[model samples]
Target: MGFLDISHVTKSYGQVQVLHEVDIAVQEGEFLVLVGPSGCGKSTLLNMIAGLEAISSGDIAIKGRVINGVHPSKRNIAMVFQSYALYPNMTVGQNMTFGLEMHGVPKPARDAALADVAKLLQIDHLLDRKPGQLSGGQRQRVAMGRALVRNPDVFLFDEPLSNLDAKLRVDMRTEIKKLHQKLKTTIVYVTHDQIEAMTLSTRIAVMNKGYVQQLGTPKEIYDTPANLFVATFMGSPAMNILPATVVMEGGQPHAEITDADGARRLLRFSQGNLAEWADKPILLGIRPEAITDPEGADRKSANIQPLANRVTVTEPAGSDTFVTMTLSGKDVIARMRADAMVAPGEVFDFAINMDKAVAFDPATEARIPQ
Candidate 1:
């Protein structure tokens, strides 16, 4: 059995079904992230795992032991909240040891636990300071230290970095990843930010409308999204999905794309067994980074094909330029080097790496297996 198992879990509120039957399995020391937009039930699922929310049906198990109705504290899980959830009046040290002290652990033992975690989290200097006196990141560390002092079986983070500024959020993300490496414990984190999930998770469960849409490693989820929802939801600027038709040209399957102006271009996919899909409509998805300059094309994989779609707009980010062009009636973005200063209305030689390009069944919005 997996270290943590969520089996056929469901949730509802008086005729309103929120979370559908959901299942996820997380291995020991695995960092699993539940990510989706607001109201998608990612937080609700985390709460269910923590025993804060009652499961309407199905079971949750920790190491094969069913914890259906277990109390939150008895579950031996520590939760760090987005708000930090620190005690206003208590100092960092006091906040860190309160749970231990409440359980009647002797003062000496509690102090020892606090000291070790404080030093480990590098918050020893701020132990005596109150949460109010600490910066957002510091307060977050104290909250984490509070959870760490218990040394629970699993760490649950409910969007812990949501309150921090962008740079601090990135820093805290690194710290959390390092902490996981150092402790090698199981963790289940919930967040609406796909970037956080991609950066922090050993595996990610992408949810939508109360259902787990896709669950896989970051690379798996990004490169081979299960459906249109996952393909459009998990990346920054999302994946560019365009309408296309599969056709056979010279015994090989190719996707024919027609822009708004009726200009046509063909993109060949590396996968086989696509001959039967000829003349059928499909959703063609390509990431911005995959459509890059010819020199930047990945040489290792031979899925690189050439095309020149007329650029309609260009957004110059510091490290890369986002070039926008109409592809098969859809606006698609391509990531190019910042120095490639192609003017709008110009047709630039864009190399497309389709080794990872995906096709979806337009009727079901499900990816077509290669």
Candidate 2:
């Protein structure tokens, strides 16, 4: 058993079932992020873990001990909520120590813990101030400090950074990462932001419509999505999925797709197993970074197919330019270096890294194993 285990867990209200057979085993000190869109049951799963919501069935255990019937206060877990649930009338230090006081902890011990955590979170100066006197970021730090003083076995973050502005969110994200590294605590963070999942997680569970679509390391989920939904949901520009047919050429499989000018083009497949799929209709998947200007193509790829296609749109996004063109009657984006001189309505030689390509069964929408 792992440090935290959710086995065969299901949740339902009345007759409408929400979560089905959800299972996850989080190792000690592992940063696991439950990421998905709003109402995907990520928060519900988290609440179940925190004992804020009871499991309809199955078990939730911590350190091999069942906690399904335990109270939220007795669960040995700390939660940093999105709203920064702090008392407006209480000073930061008082708010931080109130939980310990409620548990009958001695004043001296609570004070010591408060001092240490406040210093660690760099909020020692704000300890005497009320929640209303602090800025948003300071209030967040105080909320985190309150949880830190408890030194719980598990940390539950429910979209904790969602309330902060963009720049502060990034700053606090780094702070949280540093805190985790120093403390090495097990954390289950829930966020609707895919970028947070990619940047912060040791493993990610991507949920959709109350089901976990896929669970794996961020790299694995991004590079080899389990299905079409994961592919389209987990990235910034999203993976470009084009309708194509697998055709055999020179005893190898090639994706037969139409270019901008309505001319058919062939790109060789690096996965030799695709040869078995010859003459079959399949959806070709390629990330925008895999399609770039010739000079920006990945040097490690052996199969860099070259194609001259007319660009329909060019978006300059500071560090890189997003070039869009029609392929297989779909808008395909190519990520190119900012200095690449190609413009819209011009025929440009683009390099496609077929080595990074993936394929999906058109009917089932599941990824065809590489």
Candidate 3:
């Protein structure tokens, strides 16, 4: 019921099932990124959409038409591979237009399409050169240009920026985002890099162990993870999770955790529904940024609680300082302003923004719903 729909899609290799009951509805002109660790079946699901891998069961449709049995060429989909996959011997212009030529298109139309896409991708100067003569970024642009000239119904990218250097990867990421905005094309991109997924996708499908742990906008995924796997996987520094107990204090639910000296400390939660979990053990999830120096705490947060703890280590990371301490027998990190004056073995008053805190069912590893 979407522009690109994967309804009850599953893929199996003989007796072993890799992808299970996966469903995603990608809207028109939307950018969807499949992100997870290596061997998590992100690429396998992408291959299924590209018609390179057969679906064991279920259906994949584009614009309401099922393409389950369609050939790769006839599916009206263009793909850009991680390796660029350009012809080494063919000129850039030939490589870009060869697919059109094979479809029996006239030479004039092929030339016109090539010129427009090459200009759009800023590769007009490299059309006469071969793939061997260009830089890594230029070759990537050529690969993208090849796909753009086809005017396919969908564009599938299989870790296309993974081959570039770190700086070039960032540069290409911006370029791809700009291209998507300009053309308003539907794109399904696959990457294991969470940062790439966060920055590029309009929506992200965070997969793990052959399952989509969470599918949501970046803000939703970061702010409210569906489960423990999503909370730990999608962020750069990762969310801090520790064991805690829900205790009622003054008719309000509070998280009771142990500080560095094994002293019981209480931090009130913003979710009033947690009152039902009174006297029950739960896993508390908090992002590093939510725990900060008293002066650096979020001013808008209504539930800022003071938590004094001994800092075990202080890491100055240019823009922000990451302070580490032990709480609930687990290492907890706090992000503070780089200029904050706290050192190792010093007791600092850290602010806990309970407004941004989340609680999880420790046994099921699922987030506690508000």
| Candidate that scores best on lDDT | 3
lDDT value, residue 185 of candidate 2: 97
Q: Which stretches in model 1 have alpha-carbon errors above 4 Å? A: none
Model 2 over residues 1-370: C-alpha lDDT tens digits?
8999999999999898889888899999999999998989999999999999989999999999999999999999999998989988899999999999999999999999998998898899998998999999999999899898999999999999999999999999999888889999999999999999999999999999888899999999999999998898898898999999999999989999965567899999998899888999999999999999888999999999998888999999999999998887799999999999889999999999999899999999999998
lDDT of 2 at 99: 92
How much lDDT does each candidate structure score?
0.91, 0.93, 0.94
Error of 3 at 181 (Å): 0.8
List residue ranges in candidate 3 displaced over 4 A. 259-261
- Pairs of residues at least 3 apart in sequence or in different chains that clash in candidate 1: none
What is the lDDT ranking, best to worst? 3, 2, 1
Give per-residue CA lDDT, model 3, range 99-202, as digits (tens): 99998999999999999999999999999999999999999999999999999989999999999999999999999999999999999999999999999999
Q: What is the lDDT of residue 125 in candidate 1?
A: 98
Is 1 or 3 the stronger prediction by lDDT? 3
Which residue pairs clash in candidate 2?
A: none
- Candidate 1: what lDDT? 0.91
Candidate 3 TM-score to native: 0.98
TM-score of 2: 0.98
